[model samples]
Target chain A: MSGRKLIALWLFVVSVVVALMGFWFMATRASMDYWVMAGSLILISITCYLSGVHHYLTTKNRHGRYIILYGSVVLMVAGLSIYIPDVLDLRPWEIYTRIPSDFFFSFFMLIIGILSSYVSFRPFHNFTKEGAQSGAYYIIHLSIIFTLFPLFLIMFNIITRGMGGITWEFLTEDIVSMGEKGGVYPAILGTLAMISLTAIIVLPLGVGTAIYLAEYARKGLAVRVIRTAVNILQGTPSIVHGLFGYAFFVLILFNGQKCLLAGALTLAILTLPIVTRSAEEALNAVPGELRDASLALGATKWQTIKKVVIPPSMPGILTGTVLGIGRAAGETAPIMFTAVYFSGTGTPSGLLRPIMALPYHLLSLYRLVGYRDVEPQAWATALLLLIIVLGINLSAIIVREKYRQRF
Target chain B: MINKVLELLKEEKACQRISLPPGIKAKTSGFSLWYGSTKALKDINIEIKENKVTAIIGPSGCGKSTLLRCFNRMNDTIVSVRTEGNIWLDGYDIYDDVTDCVDIRRKVGMVFQKPNPFPFSIANNIYYGCQVNDMDVEKDEVVERCLKQAALWEEVKDRLSENALSLSGGQQQRLCIARALAIEPEVILMDEPCSALDPIATAKIEDLIHELKKDYTVVIVTHNMQQAARVSDYTAYMYLGELIEFGKTKQIFEKPREENTEKYITGRFG
Candidate 1:
């Protein structure tokens, strides 16, 4: 038989072995502790099969099919041992959650897996071409499907939890009471203010430095130093940045006080290198031909930059800003140092008054979850925070897409 | 008496081409240029007659584009670039310390080789140069006159509001030409303007060049020998950053004075 036919046969045999193993795993007691391991094995087997590596590695004159069968049996035994060392030790409560009663998914997956593996690995007898008709495209499609599964799970979780607590009051009213009735209005407003101030500080300084490096300054010791500083800045940990922000902005600048300005300033410093590097890349990406065209058309260097280069780089600059926002919103350690706690009366009397943020609020709510008074409130707050962050991220993507359509 | 008659005929023929009365010259001077420590153009002297096409033909890296850029002081923007030259335009030394490079550029507009129309409407692209240079003009009249002068009014009349990028490559180049013309420059420098265009588009540009000589003194750098011969009145051929020959296009193509020029024109070496 041709190599293609042999490979196809190997794929079929391997899928059958995996399907059998999955069946064995599902058929075992529902009180098993090896659920994660079983899940992982199933994923690995599917990954190998779909990627077509399973066929390539095994079956020497159908000897490879035997290796898969042996490997799956060993894997299934090991997975069972790892998850559930002793069936006698299994708890009665664990039985309910551990074993899924509906075996339809496993069975359905087995059929689909057999069909797909056979279809993808099938040999073409009529074509004169040597070697397998490259399955790299299918392999990529499988990889994408694998990656999308986790993202889909996350989205589903977010929507199920998030939509429950999201409301006008949740978005706009301040968190007045301690538990459930309190809203994230102050936290939302605080985040907006923090981000806006960060932009105000970062944009000019970052863009100016980028311009100086890209356009004004020559490649020398100073430029190298600046570039190194920027790379280091980008590599610095968020928690380390939090420490620096506390030590520098909160303590040194404001005399050991946390204020809105302090938080914004810290975030700005954190965002500066990112913005500079991104803006420099954007500026560099502008074709030299465009600049030459503008200059030849009697535009001065400044005029050329303002008219041609900036407009083309706007989309990239916006992307950098979005990434910076992502970093700013998710950070809890920095806010813990610089700005935490929401005043109950209303929005901060001034910039100096401390403000609450969604991430910290979620953390507080999570800490209070065991308490009867705050458990529901905690869930509601977590849901609201997720919604806000998601909204910001999605809008940024939309804005970037709008500009990309022009190109 | 016979010698005087011959001289009179020669003067009359020069008048028909150059247009200026006796003793009045368009512009001529010593020009030396540098990019950092590297001298690009050295002690070059040439006269550009009013209302005539002067083609600068040379191999790559010979500073043809550099010399073209000097007319508008575009090199002034380069921090390391310097010039020890006298470039007089209408009896004014353009490189005088007080001369504004911006104003000089407005007067000496340029069209690049590849069509580099702004990502804007055709109308906006044409009006931008004028709006930048002459901001006080009555908008409609300026736009109409400039479009007519560029020979683009008829073709682009209906689609003036359309994006410049939506036009064909040749049309974009013409829009770029219209943009330069709108500034009402005394000279227009074209740096291998048709190099990026198709043959038909190139032919259209050559025809436009013939028509442009009536109102603008055009200096073009072209790699196409046939293009230089067909379009220009005078051609200066350079090699390795040195001027090898400067003469009528007919003489440069038909009977070059320099051996190197002969070799280059004969496709021996670039």
Candidate 2:
């Protein structure tokens, strides 16, 4: 094997070991030994020197040159700091001796390990196709790892902190004393009712708009204007939608009463752009040839859209609508002003009455954290809200996969 | 160029010794089409004989397919397309303001260049036209008759419930033909029907065209000269949006009528 390949293998092994040790220390909170720190420092300096050599061998005009330069300078500073007191002839009482924390040692080892491995795997002097490909593959894998790390951390934190509050009773009762004592059955029911109503209200409006845009509308000023309006609606904040619902649906339409209908309408408005855009995409995905064939077969425009166009796009339409409904289920601001009550309302009785929803209930519980004992219930509400949203999204994916068309 | 084309038409009309079968299924007079600002067809006039195969032959962008689409009013779907002409189906003015495009399309069915079957089962693909037309017929009977007419029954009869897209390209085109036939149209327009198929599949479609002309008037647009000669009783040669020549396919291919027609048929020029 070439010397470069050998060094690559060594770097790979050292990176794996250091990463595993870092994870272990993070998990166990174990203090690292002084000798281990000293050994890691020696390894880091060697890695810096080897990376600098590889940088010189590869190319003079590359980004890796600066990394190696900075790495060596940082290593020099760390080395000089360790001997500064002895060189100045200062007593132990006069100068403070720094002790390397486990996190710092682990972090240093990780950075050095990444630098060495990157320097080692890269070509020594000339650029070949395989070298570029391997470099791309390494960077892509690193990116994937970085991307997944935050999601895993978030899920881990939520499950660990929120799992204790989930009991059968907690799931089946009502909130008591500002959400300090009881369960969240009413809130869950209210959330389901609101989102279901939102889906009902939005599906026809959104899909109708999508059909008009995709199959009927000519590409002219009217279409461009409507498309621009939909895009602007999509980019508008949910809070603005909430405020609009509060002003229009609550104050004007309902005479300033917060009601379930107002909340659903607000959420429908918020998700309409999403559903419309996706449904239009879905409708557009049905090839024009199919429409032409239908028209050639003597089917009228409406008949062709109903039979030939809609069936193939049904999966896409449903997936988009379901995703929009999922967003509606978790949204807090849209309902806070228009529909939900913090307590007292047991469950959804009618469309005209305000009801307690999970997101709003969670917000209420969070507000009462120090004044009352509602932290566990707040975590539990968050967990429940997450579950509902994820469930809706999962079903959307399942439906999409089940009914996906080839052409 | 216009005078030369008119002279050829005049000469051909005067020397019409070869007797053709009676009955005009469709005709166009002073027909022209435009796509936005670009004129696609110019003063196209031809009579498609009933129960006979008429092939339109031209190079690419020569408006052969455009003329065929005008027969069934399929060009109406394109928003930017504008037409200034009159087309008649069965001696009735189809382009009249009172005429319904749906009824015209029912009388004139079209098969596209590329096969486009709905994302449906093979049986449903055939039944789709019948269902859309609201024809009160037995589903199995219509499916069998149409599939047999397209010569795809034996291969796909046992798997009628399978998705139509699972079929090969040749089979899919035949299925589209069957779908068109299920509507029971009096005329069938095919636009480069074999362009996307293999040689064997092309031959099969040519044979199918020959069989179809016994019952329905078949108008086909093709780039291949030999396919036109093999299938069409009458051929119309178009170039650059003008109908250069229209006559018996045998005479057009074998004898010299117009220099441009002879040039195109003899592989001298498009």
Candidate 3:
């Protein structure tokens, strides 16, 4: 290797080692002496500076050089403030001392590692198009990691904390002593019944509206008005939908009774816009040439849609509808007012009967946290809700991959 | 004001129709079409002879495809399109208020420029037209007859259950022809059907057109003048939405009638 490349490689290795030490400190919550922290910061900052200079010499691009230098200098100055506070005169020495040592060390190490690696890769790429492309790939991969990290963290936290509460007896029995014990069998059944009814009500209405909008409706005032209404409906809060369902379906239609039908209707209304918009997109994704070919073959407009357009777009429509249903399944606000009771109602008995749903039951368990031993049950209910929603979403993905049409 | 101008042009062009021979399967009389405000076909008057290959040849955007689409009322699919005057199929005005467009389409089949096969088995694609038309027929027999008529039976007979989209471009175009034939329409309209095919595929389609005219009346829109000369019995040359000349293919290619026809045929100007 050339002299410049050799030096860059050595700096990259040192930066990675420092980063690993920083991670160890953060993970174990270890306290470091002021001298050790200061020394590590200085080492990382010098490594960053040399690598940045090496990249600048090779590529003649000042952007990466200035950025790396700026990051390293800021970290070094911050690190020095805790040790020699009067030099920068930015903050009181007491304030700098109060800041946790591990947090500062981890943050400094992360920045230095990122900067060093960027400069290390730059020497290899030399700021060519391929270098820019590789740089873009790295940024995108980092962004994906950032997005998935929080989701996985939440799932891990829930599964670990909730695992103890999910026993066979916990799943099959009714609530005892205000959910201090017993399972959520009725709540599970109630949730299944509500979502199933919601799907039945929403699918035909959403798919029909989608077909009309995509196939028959002209791009005029009526279509524009309908599209705007769907957009507004989709953005409306779930709480408002709950209130409206209480007033309309419960008060007017059911003679002041809270029922499963009322809650399913509200959810159907809540998810209608999602299903309609997605189904319309799926229908529109079908190429116009296919419709033309069908029409040119002496098939009527309706026949052509039924035979040619619907078959290819069915996968997209189902995926969107399943996603909408997944959203409907987890929603607590809309059903709490119109459909679910706190505890009295066991599994659903009739269309007009109120029932205990998982989300509402979890809410009740959360309220009884201090007075009763229900925290584990609350966590278990949350885990179950997550599983149901994720399961529905996974099925949608499977359906899309299985039946996806090319043309 | 546009109607008055069209009426005047109709009178001026009345003498040109006098020389047209018999066996008129479809005819357009002073038929003009506008897409929104843009006129695409203006005062087009031509007669399609029964059981003959009639080719419409002109430069791009000259209303040759528009005139071909008018025979089956296929242009009705475009929302912006507006038409005046009438197109007659088998001596009946197809644009009349009482005429059912579905019924008109059933009697007249169409093939498009690009091979657009439905995402179905090859046999199912052929069976689709019959199913929609409510025709009770032996499925195997109809599939066989139509494929044979399209000259694709031997090539695709074993793969009848395969997706039509799996076929090669030439095979797909021919499959589309077989699908069009399944409904048993009298007149078949082709809109630049071979434009997307290779030279050998184009040759196959041209040969199929020669065999097709013995039974079905064929109205083809083509950009290739040589194909028109080789395949067509009657040729119509149009320019800027108006029919410039209509006569035997030999005369249109040989003797001079209008100056525009001579210029376009001689490559002097489009």
The reply for model 1, stretches above 4 Å from the true place, is: A1-135, A162-177, A342-346, A371-376, A405-407, B1-43, B76-88, B91-99
Tell how far residue A176 is off in model 2, in angstroms: 1.3
> Per-residue alpha-carbon lDDT of model 2 for A77-101, expressed as tens digits?
4464444231232346676545445
Docking class of 2: medium
Query: Residue B180 in candidate 3 has what lDDT?
Result: 92
Candidate with maximal lDDT: 3
Q: What is the lDDT of residue B88 in candidate 1?
A: 74
Residue lDDT tens for model 3, A201-228: 9999999999999999989999999999
Which prediction has more favorable DockQ, 1 or 2? 2
DockQ of candidate 3 is 0.66
The residue pairs in collision within model 1 are: A33-A83, A34-A83, A58-A64, A59-A64, A60-A64
lDDT of 2 by residue, B64-112 (tens): 9989999888988888999888777766777776677899899899999
Looking at model 1, residue A190 earns an lDDT score of: 76
Candidate 3 chain A: 10-residue stretch with minimal lDDT: A84-93
C-alpha RMSD by candidate, in order: 10.5, 8.8, 6.3
Error of 2 at A256 (Å): 1.7
